[model samples]
Target: MAIKIYGSFRSPFVMAVALAVYEKEQEFELLMMNIKSPEYMNNFNPFGKIPSYQDEDITLFESRAIMRYVATKFEGQGAPLLGSTFSEQALCNQWLEVNGHSFTPAIVEMAFSKADTESSKLAFEKFEKVLDVYEARLSVSKYLAGDSYTLADLAHTPLFHIFMAVSDDEKKKCLTSRPHLHAWIQDISSRPAWKKVTERPENTFYKPRTESQ
Candidate 1:
């Protein structure tokens, strides 16, 4: 079978994985399963989470793992998913860990807090601190991994897209507050492939809400 991706567009993690596939000039079928359902839990990912990838060679779960798989498999076809230099590659891994273990959680909490009576203020405060680190690093480098955009930078694209769309106020938070980070965000967000990915008819994720975003 063709590469089959299991998950909904509702997840930024899922969207990032999809973006990685597209960046590699490949297509995949988007399959959303009720993660808690027996079939999904048992046959796909026993952990009952979204975003599993399958093809003739093997099956995979976790967005980062899936992205890595695509990067390794299609290395010759598209954007250098992994960095060219050893140091850049190491930074790529470090930043991806930040995307997973640090930055995304606070930012996601800030997003989900919109749906419930949660501590959005605290989340925002925490997110700002994270952004501060990004601003510092970006002031020195053009992309997260180095001079060229890598998987680490691509991983956060969907996130910054949503953050830009929540509201004008939120969008400004992404730009007006952090000059270096904002510039890097704007640069990466301007990719033609990213525009195409968002415009895909099958997309069911959050829509852009800003006039310029």
Candidate 2:
């Protein structure tokens, strides 16, 4: 059976999974459904969240887990997303955790919080601290897991795309002010796999706001 993904492309989590599949040189059918429906909840994701994945051997939810599976299952086809060495692999896993726990939460806050509110202020502060750590780490390493591209780097591309699209010039300084972090974002966002994900017609939901509109 062919691979199938259930979710809206507007979700960064869904897009992240798509990016991973493309990086592995695999194609999938993108499906949409009522996630809260009993059939979907019971079969795909019990939590009623988006971005569930299915293939011949398994049904899986959670974008990160699905991404790891794609990387492993198609290990020889396209981009080597698992990192080249033992140490690099370990680092890749570590950074993947950091992306979920540290980076993602802060970016989500910054993306959704109302401007000038205490919550927005706090989110920016938290985001800047996380970026400080990223700047320090990326200053020396070419990618999050090391010198090579890995799932660690792939996971952040979609989130950053959304964040960059929604954020204004001032808010963008959180990334642009940090040279290493800025450069890293530019590099990862430029990959063909990611470009493919962004170019899909379904990706039209998160467009940047123009002054006139």
Candidate 3:
């Protein structure tokens, strides 16, 4: 059976999972579900989340978990997303945690809040600190988990895409100011799999905007 991903590209979680599938050289059916419907709740995700994964073997929720499963299940097929070495694997997991606990919150706040507002200022402060951390780490390493691209880096791509789409030049200075971090974003965002994701019709809604636009 073809893998079915329940949600739309509007949800970064859904896009992340789709990117993982593509990284593994797999195809999936993008789908929508009435998340609150009993059929969806019982069969897909009890919590009624936007992205739920269904394959021949199992059905799963939680985007990170789905990405991990895809990376592991399709290992050796395409890009080796789950780190090739034990150390890389450990670091991959560590950075994945950082994406969840530290990075996501700050980026979410920055993306959604009104510019120049008190909340936006606080978010920028927090986000800049996090970007500083990334800049330092990426300065030394080519990729988050080492030289090889891993789920750690993949997890961050969609959020950055959305940030770029909605942010103005002044706001984007947070990302573009950090040389290494900016380079890393460019590298990841340039991947062919991500290109396909962005080119999909569903992604039209989040098309990146420049200050002049």
For model 3, how big is the CA root-mean-square deviation?
1.4
lDDT for 98 (candidate 3): 96
lDDT for each candidate structure: 0.84, 0.91, 0.92
Predicted candidate 3 versus true structure: per-residue lDDT over 1-213, tens digit per residue: 999999989999999999999988889999997999999999999999889999999999999899999998988798999898999999999999999999998888777888779998888898999999999999999999999999999999999999888878877888898999999999999999999898888776786785642
Ranking by TM-score: 3, 2, 1
Tell me each candidate's TM-score: 0.92, 0.96, 0.96
Question: Which of 1 and 2 is ahead in TM-score?
Answer: 2
Model 2 lDDT at residue 42: 98
lDDT of 2 by residue, 82-114 (tens): 999999999999999999999999888777898
What digit string (tens of lDDT, one per residue) describes model 1 on residues 9-84?
7778888888898889888888877889998888889999878999889888989988988988999988987998
lDDT order, best first, reads 3, 2, 1
Highest lDDT: which candidate?
Answer: 3
Total clashing pairs for each candidate: 0, 0, 0
